[model samples]
Target: MNKNPVDAALILVFLYPLLKGFLFKFSSKNMKSDIEEIGGYISFIIGVILGTYLTKKIFMIHQDGVYAKIYNNIPEQIISALESKPLLIYVLVMPIIIFLIYKVVQIIIDLINSITLYPLLDSIEDLLKGKSGFVKRIIGLLFQLPKGVCYVILLALVLNVLVIIGVNDTYNKKLNESKLYGNICKNIINPITNSKLAKKIPNVINDSFKIVIKNSEDQPGNESGKTIVYYNGITLSEGIKSNEEIDSFSRELVKNKKTSKEKAKIIYNWIGQNIEYDYDKVDKILDNDFTIKSGAINTFNTKKGICFDYSCLYSAMCKANNIKVRIVTGEGFNGSNWVSHAWNEVYISEENKWINVDTTFYKGGNYFDSSIFKLDHKDRKIAG
Candidate 1:
């Protein structure tokens, strides 16, 4: 991701209006001819810019270190093979490629509807009247040309000049420096800021903390297994306050017994059943705690978060149950510009492999059930 606020702000300034315009014109009944709908093409162009901005933001947030690692790891043979592949194969082989083409086609369609069809139709409506003064007719014909062309041209030139000035100015040099400094802060400060209670525990227990401290008791050679157990125990403790609470919840759900999957299912159902999607509420809650500890409760109570919140919470809950989990964030179906989405890869011990879990759609109470969690791991390249 570029991490340039000017670039992002410029993109948003252009896209928000364009996308909104496209949607409005496309659905409006007042648009009788295509030429008058030139406004719609303007909107589509904005959408493209907005989509680009979104893609960059997502990549920055989710795939922090993955890109550098991938670049370093890329083999000469692999690069050669990739480079040698025919361009035509992109249509058949890469889903992301195909999706990009579709988005381009959509833009083209909007352009045609706005510039060509709408203008011609509006002109036809004017021409249908047989009588007019010669000067009046000439002025009307000039008016038929697309509106705001001169203004747009001037705006573009001014923007280009400003960009050049900003790039050259010593004052702007500080902006890049500040940006780099911010990135460093994010890399170092973020982990400490976000670390949970479990992550703070020492290898050797001093009996200061009240929890079981499983890993510390287990001696040397068996340390790794004990660490996993310890982390898993911390996760459970954080998830539910007490074993009594867990037992009571389990008994309420069934007559006698409950497996890990059953317990997970219960949590999943509860989240979906309780939480409503409320963005403002979620943002307000998260503004207080940036840690992963703000999981299902954040989602359930606030009822809003982007896909990241949804998947992270799901993974956290699975982890709480001693289930090993990995969170995957990537572009979804259709080359949708890889906007941020998150889902979990759960390790089912009985199956001995990771399986995908999407809690967002699940939480939506099946409103988005169709094709919701349909992402394939093979389709996703790991982002940090």
Candidate 2:
């Protein structure tokens, strides 16, 4: 439950790949400095940078949802721990201590290599005189372990360079929205972009476009859409006009439900089983030709919509039941494509925490993680 993404990423960069040699019997950089110096310093620097990023991400990542409970109390936790162990500050700097230990070990490794490597390799070629088999080739490749290690060290840096682009919000936004990143699912041929590749190599990159993986697009969501439905003489969009209907819907679901969770589950099941997704409407919504008033009012009236309709309609029902509810906006992945989504967050006093409820996903078989509407859902904003 560390839940520190940066710390996890740092370990992947500095320790995970290197430790692969020990864990899976596999696994590596510098010229001005030797391999040991380069590796030890690189690992320490990366660790420090990631540790810094973790401090920032923890506060910012969980600002708007049930997940906020994980990080919002972090300050209190630190205070309590410090109260128990007055010298907790020293423990927090353990990474620095570990770095120093790495440096000492590196110095020893450098010394051992300097003293023993040359003498060991001097007449080693003569030992392999008649060896022409694959084993000899393998052994010969093993002799270049120093170079392999250096290459891996450099590879780690290259990988982190890609990662740094993602961790920074400004860079990430630019990348995700860029035409360079959005090279549509359709393949396109262009003169300037394709000419250079065609000349350099024949079809080396047949699919010559930058690959970018991003969460679903940003949306303010149906909070505004709900208001749009109020223009006329309050039709289906008028939950107030439709109060009797809402009461009827709730009577069947919330009856004899003494607890908030039970009421929420009954509502969830009702919607999941009754309402359906309208695939034909997707293209219209994207084209902006569709009506925007398609909110809670339109949803219950129609009983079918995209994610927006599902969330707004669900919130409207919860409101009728006298339950506290909020519409949440974010993105989700259903194992393949990532798309913008809207869902509900209901406060159940029994749990004393907001439970994520993704009615849209309830159709996908099972969608019951209150902690996260979907393991793939990432909370981005509150009401909108």
Which candidate number maximizes lDDT? 2
Over 159-234, each residue of candidate 1 has an lDDT whose tens digit, in order, gives 3323322334332333333443234223322222222211221111111111234554456656455543222123
Model 2 Cα lDDT, one tens digit per residue, 122-228 = 45545656756554545544443544444444443333334332344444334333332223111222111122221221111111111122232332553432333
User: What are the lDDT figures for the candidates, one per model?
Assistant: 0.40, 0.49
At residue 332, candidate 1 shows an lDDT of: 36
- Model 1 gets an lDDT of 0.40
User: In candidate 1, where is summed lDDT lowest over 10 consecutive residues?
Assistant: 201-210
Root-mean-square deviation of every model: 16.2, 15.3
On TM-score, the candidate that comes out on top is 2
Q: Which regions in candidate 2 have their CA more than 4 angstroms from the true location? A: 1-242, 371-374
